[model samples]
Target chain A: MVKLKGAISGLGKMGLSHAAIVGAHPEVDIVSVCDTSTLVLDAFKRFTKVKTYTDYQKMIDNESLDFVVIATPTRIHYEMVRYALEKGIHTFCEKPFSLTIREGEDLVTLANQKKLVNQVGYHNHFIGTFRDLKRLLDTDVLGDLVHFTGEAYGPVVIKEKSGTWRSDPKEGGGCLFDYASHVINLIQEIIGRPTKANGSQLKRIYSKEVDDAVYSILTLESGLSGVLSVNWSDETYRKMSTSLTILGKKGKIICNASEMKIYLKEANSKENLGKGWTIKYITDFAIPVNFYLRGEEYSAQIANFVDCIIRKSQTEINSFKQALITDKVIELLIADSKN
Target chain B: MKMDKVLFGDNQFFAVNHLSDEKSREQAIRFKDDAAIIRVLDQAREIGISTFMCTTHDRIANVCDYVRANPEKYRGFKIYPCMPYAHKYANAVTDLGIIGTIKQYIPGNIFSTFTKGGVAFIRKDFIGFMELFIDAEMKMFKGINTPVIFIQNVLVDLILGLKMFDVFKEYDSYIRKKYNAEPGYITMNLPALLDSLNSIGIENPIICSSINKIGFRMSGGINIYEKYLTEKTFRPIALQVLAAGALRPKEAIEYIGKFPKIESVLFGASSKSHIQETKELIEQYL
Candidate 1:
C-alpha cells in the first residue's frame, strides 16, 4: 500500500481525532501539526509524536507532508484549502468548507483543476448505517421517495470562546453554515439537486450576530419534498446528532446517527444483515429491522477514502467541491431570516 | 341591475392573500376534480346542500356562468343573488342600467339635489342615512318575484358593535317592510343580533360567516353547535348550549352538514384541486 504523509491543522477536537488515527494508521503518517496556540501545539506534539508549529504557512513550507487536514474554522477554510491544493497537497476539511458560495466554488475549482484528493468531513455519509441505507435506496428498498426530513440541534458553546476561529463569519461560525451542511449533503445523497429552495433562520437568543436556529424546505427535481431544522444555542442540550427519515412509495428508513440506530420499514428481511429490531407488515407493524452504527461506519468511511486514494478511483468521497452545494443552502436561510 | 341569468365562481380566492405562483394554483386546483363550481354543487348534493347565495352582485355573472355551464350538476342548487345594497352597489345599480326606472319613482332630485344653502335642513333627513337611498332602490327590486338574500357584510357588525343599533334596526326594518317580505336572512356578523333575533324572536335566521367574514349570528350562537365549541369567545356559550340541549346532537350535525342558513357557502376557489378538497372536506368533516 502507498503510505500517505499527513499533517493536521488547528489541533482542536476534530484535528486531534484525525491526528490520533492518522498517526496510528498503517498507510498514514502524522508528520506535523499546525495551530496558533502554543499550548495546543505542545499537546498535539506529545500525543502524535510529530513536529508542531504556531504558523500554518511555516508548517506547509517546512514539513515533508503529502496532505493536510483543514480542521480550522469555516472562515479560514478557503485560504487553507487553497494553499494546500496549490502546493499539490491532498486535504480533508471539516464542514461547511467555506463561509460563502464563492469561496467554496473557488476552492472546488482549484482542487478539481489540480486533481487533488480532497474530502469533506460529512462523516454521516460515511457512517455504516447510512451507507446501508444508501444501499437499500439504490436497491429500491424504499421504492420512489415521497419525502425526507433531517433534524439536528444541540447546545452552542461560543465557538470563539472555545479558542477556535469558528466564531468568525469568515470561517463559518454560525449554525446555518456550520451544522446544516451535514443535513444538506445527506439530502443530496438521498435525493438529487433540488429544483426550488426556501429557508428561514432565527436570531441567537444568546449571541447577537449569528443565527442560532434555522429551518429549510426544498423541493427536488423529482417532486420529492424535504425539510431540515437546525439550531445551536441550546443550553438545554449538549452533543450533536442527526436523524434522517425518508418516506418512499414502498417503504421507509429512519436513521438516528447520534444514537447510531437505523430502522427500516421494508417488505421483506435480509438474513446476513443481522437480527433487526421488530418486523411486521405495513398495517400491522411499521418498522422491520434496526441496525446500530457499531463503530463500523467510521472505519468504513476511512477505508473508502484510503481505497479511493490508492486506486485513483472516481468516487463521491474526497470531493469537497460536490459537498459545497450545501453552503448555498446556508446563504438562502440568512437572506430570508425573519428574526 | 339587469343581470344575465347565469354566473361563474372563477375568481380564485386563495385561503391566504393571493395565488402567488403556479404551484399554489396547481395545488388549489388539485383539491378537486373538474372545477370548483361543479365540485361544490356535487358535494353539497351528496350531503343534501340546497341553496347557495353570493353576497355581492359582482359575483352574479360568474355564478350564472357556473350554473349555465353545468346545468345538470347544479340543478338542485338554488342560486340566491344577494346584494350588499347598504354599501357599495347602490351607485353601481345605475351604472349597470337597472336604476333608470327606479330613479324615476324616487327621482334624482332626492339623491343629487343637495343644496349648500339648505344643507342644515337635509342633515336631519339624509345626512347619516345614505343607506336609505339604497333601501328605496331595493324596494323596487322586490317586484322581481325571485328570492333576494341580502348580506349585511362585516362592516355592519362594527357599526352594531359600536352600539349604533339604530342603523341595524333601520336596515332590518327596511328589508322587511318595503320588500313586502322578510329577507330570507340578514347576513350581519354580530352575535348580539342573534340575541336581538332571540329577543324580538325574528324568524329570519342570521347566518354568520367565518370569524373574519364579518357577518353576524350571536358570538355564542355558533357555540350552540359542536364546531364552535373550541373557539375562545364561543366555547363557553357552546358549553351552555350543549347543557341547554337547544339542538339535539343529531340535529346539530345535520345543521352543520348543510350550508349556513343564507343559502350556500360562497368562497373563492382557484383550482380544481381546491374544489376536490372542498368536496372531500365537506363530505368528511361537514
Candidate 2:
C-alpha cells in the first residue's frame, strides 16, 4: 500500500484533531507538523518520531509532502494555500476559508489551475441527517420551496475575554466566521446560495470587537428567501447547535445535527415516509466510518479528501470553489450589516 | 464491573438527556439546584439503587462532596465516576495551559513527570500522561466508594479508532493498581471495541453501551450485539434501553430482559414515579 506523506500547520483545537485523524489514516503518514506554540509541538517532538517545525514554509520546503492540512487562522490562509497549491500538493484547509472574498476567489482559481484535490472542512455536508435531508429535497418531497430559516447557537462567548486568536477579528474570530459561516454553508449546500442579504444586524453582547450574533434575511439565487440567525453567547445551548427549517407547498422539513423531522400532507410510499410527521434520529441512518472522532462527519470529510487525492480527482462535496460561494454570502451579510 | 442489578444514572441531573432537546432543557431547569439532585438521588436510594454511574462533571463534585459528608445515610453507595468529562477539559485547557491544567488537577506528581524530558520521557512518561490524566479525572471521587471507574466514550472511541489499544491495558491496570478498582469502558461501538480490548488481552471486560430493541446508537448494527450477548463472555450493561424515549419502559426492559447475559440496566429519570416504574420494570424483566 502506498502512503501519502502529510504535514499539518497550526496546532489549535481543530489542527490537533486533524493531526490525530490523518495520522491514524492507513494510507497517510504524518511526516511533519508545524506550530508556533512549543507547548503543543513538544508533544509531537517528545512522543512521536514526526519532525516538528515552527515555520510553515520550512515544514513544506523541508518535507516535500504529498499533502498538507492547513488549520491556521484566517489571516494567513491565502499565502499558505497559495504556496501549497504552487507546490502542487493536495490541500485540506479549514472552514471560513479566508478573511477576504478575493483571497478565497484567488485560491479557488489557483486550486483549479493546479489540478490539485482541495477540500474545505465543511463537515456538515457529510453528516448523515443533513445528507439525508439533501436526498429528500432532491426527490422534491418539499414541493415548491416556500420559505426557510437557518439557525445556529452556542456558548462560545459568554464573557468578555481577549488575547486568544478567537478574540482577534483579523484572525476571523467571531460569531460570523466561527458560527454563522457553518450555518450559511450548510444552507447554501443543502438549499441554494443566497444571492442577496439584507435587514442584517450584527449584535454584540459580550465581545467588544466582533459581533457575538448575526441576524439577516437572505434571497437565494432561486429567489427563495429565508432568515439566517446565529448567536454564540447563548448559554442555553451546551455546544454549537445548527438547525434548518424549510417550508413548502407539499410538506415541511426541519433538520439539525442529531435528527430530521419531516411533515407531509399525505403518505409517500416511495420514500417510506408516512403521512403527517416522520421523525428520524441521526443514529438510525448514520454510516459507519473506519475512524471515528467528535462525530462521523469529521472523519467522513477527511476520508473524502483522502479518497479524492487517491483518485486524483478535484470535485468534492466541499471544494474551494463551492466554499468561496459561501464566502461570498458571508461577505454580503457583513456588507449588509454595515448599511 | 460489579454493580447493582439496577444502576441509577446522573444524566438527568446534568441535563444530558440524549434524544429530546426539549426534555434536556426541562431537566436543566428542573435540576438547577444541587438540592434537586440530592432529592432525586434519595428517591433512587429509597428504591434500593446503590450505584450511580455518572460522568465526572463539575456538578458531580458537589454530589461527591455530599456523598462524602453523609457517611451513614449513604452506606454501601458506590459511584462509577466516568473520567475526563470532555467539556471540562475543553474549557480548562483554554483557561489553563496544558501543564497548568494537569498541575491544577494532579498537584502532586506533575512536575516529576515533566522533569523527565526526552526519549526516556517518551518511553515512560507517555504512560505517565495516561496515568496522570486518570489520576486527575479521579481526583473528584476521593474517599468515596467507586468500585468501577469508566473512561468516557469520547476518549475510548478515539483511542479505539486510532488503534492505540494499549491505552485500554494501561487504563485497566492503572485503575486496578492505583485505585484498587476495575476499569469500565463506555462506547457507542460495542463490537469493534470488544475486538480491540480482546486483542489487547483485556478479556471479558465490562462495557456499557446502548442496547435497545431498535438499535439506536448501536454501531455495527443490532445483529452483532445480539451475537455478543448470546455468545461472547463479558459483562454487558444496558443503557439508553429506552432508546431516548422512543420505546416504552416496559417494552424496552422486556426486550433487554431476553438477554440473560446483560448484567445490569442503567437509567436516569427526574420524577419519582418514573424512577420507581423503571426499577420495577427492570426487576420484572432483567
DockQ of each: 0.00, 0.27
* Top-scoring candidate (DockQ): 2
Report the lDDT tens digits of candidate 1 across residue range B116-142: 422333345442333555554344233
Clashing pairs in 2: none
Give the per-residue lDDT of model 2 (tens digit) for B1-286.
Answer: 3567899988888767655576678988998999999999999999888899998787899988999999999999989998877765554343343444555566556566556543344344577777766777788899998998899887787666545677688889989999998889998778888988998799889899889998777766688889988999888999889988789899899999999989899899988999999999998898
Global lDDT of each candidate? 0.51, 0.84
Q: Which candidate achieves the best lDDT against the true structure?
A: 2
Model 1 misplacement above 4 A: A45-48, A157-164, A234-238, A258-266, A269-300, B1-286
> Per-residue alpha-carbon lDDT of model 1 for A90-203, expressed as tens digits?
777877777778888898888888887778877777554555566667777666788888877665443323222444455466666666777777777755665456655455
Off by over 4 Å in 2: A49-51, A62-64, A265-275, B91-136, B160-173, B189-205, B211-236, B242-262, B273-286
Q: Tens digits of per-residue lDDT for model 2 on A1-339?
A: 879999989877678778867876779988988988776676666546789899998778889899999998888989999999999889999988988888898999999898999999998988888999999999999899999999998777777755356667878877888889999999899999899998999998878788889999999999999999999888797767889999999999999878899999988899999989998887676666655567778777888999988988875599998888988888998899989
